[model samples]
Target: MKQEDTIDFHIKRTWQSIAKMYNEEASKYDATMATGYVLLNIDKEEGTPSTSLGPKMGMEATSLSRILKNMEERGLIERRKNPIDGRSVLVHLTDLGLEKRADAKQAVVRFNEAIFSAVPEQKLEIFFEVISKVNELITNRKIYLKEV
Candidate 1:
């Protein structure tokens, strides 16, 4: 096969591997990346509306609501009526949520270390640059904007 075809094949396999890994560790992912994102966003905007939260987390309204629900049940977040907009609700992190967020931060550091350790140190930067370029191309798809 051509070099381009080989690259494409490996890319597909790499993504499949990533998906499988996430599926296997689904529970750990939520409390780490999911919680970390919410915590960071909350730190930036302490009482953000659920509507805005979805965009920050790259999630749809339904998905964000589900995540919020799980976090709420875990005592990681709290919702209250927005005083400025009675019809809308705002999300805030409780003390427990902040503590969990701290833990999640550490978990992410360890997780990333384990993942990146496989890459040869000299090639790691180039690998990430390629990943970034691919992500940019994917995210800039005109068809996606049309759908939204």
Candidate 2:
């Protein structure tokens, strides 16, 4: 096989692996759950705008907006006019949103730790470096979550 084909094969395989992992945890991996998870990080200090959510989630604006509307109706989150900028809207997590965020965070932590614990300690640093280099070369965005 050609080098390009080999790379594509690996990429597809990698995605499948991740998706399978997510499927195994599907009850916790719903997009709505993620929306709530993301909401937990928002507050008066962060003051995240609803529009910024799409870029953060790698979703289209329309999809994010629809999800946001549903969340709003469910009372998980609330949007208010930004005090600093009238044009911007800030998203705040309601009490229930915060609870969901905490649960989602614990699930993510447990899942990721399970995956990382299987890796050899000595190779972990180099593994991250290699992935980071590949991401840097192909896309300007960062590869893994770094707590924003």
Which candidate number would show the highest TM-score if scored against the true structure?
2
Clashing pairs in 2: none
Give lDDT tens digits, candidate 1, residues 54-82.
88778788877887898899898899899
TM-scores of the candidates in the order shown: 0.64, 0.74
Model 1 RMSD in Å is: 5.1
Q: What is the lDDT of candidate 1?
A: 0.73
lDDT of 1 at 105: 60
**For model 1, which pairs clash?**
none
lDDT of 2 by residue, 1-148 (tens): 7765775578788878766665456455343454644665566355578877777777788877887888788777889898889999998877877776676667678877986899887788887887678878668655444694
- lDDT, residue 97, candidate 1: 82
Q: Which ranges of candidate 2 are over 4 A from the true structure?
A: 2-5, 23-33, 40-45, 140-148
Q: 145, model 2: CA deviation in Å?
A: 28
Q: What is the lDDT of candidate 2?
A: 0.71
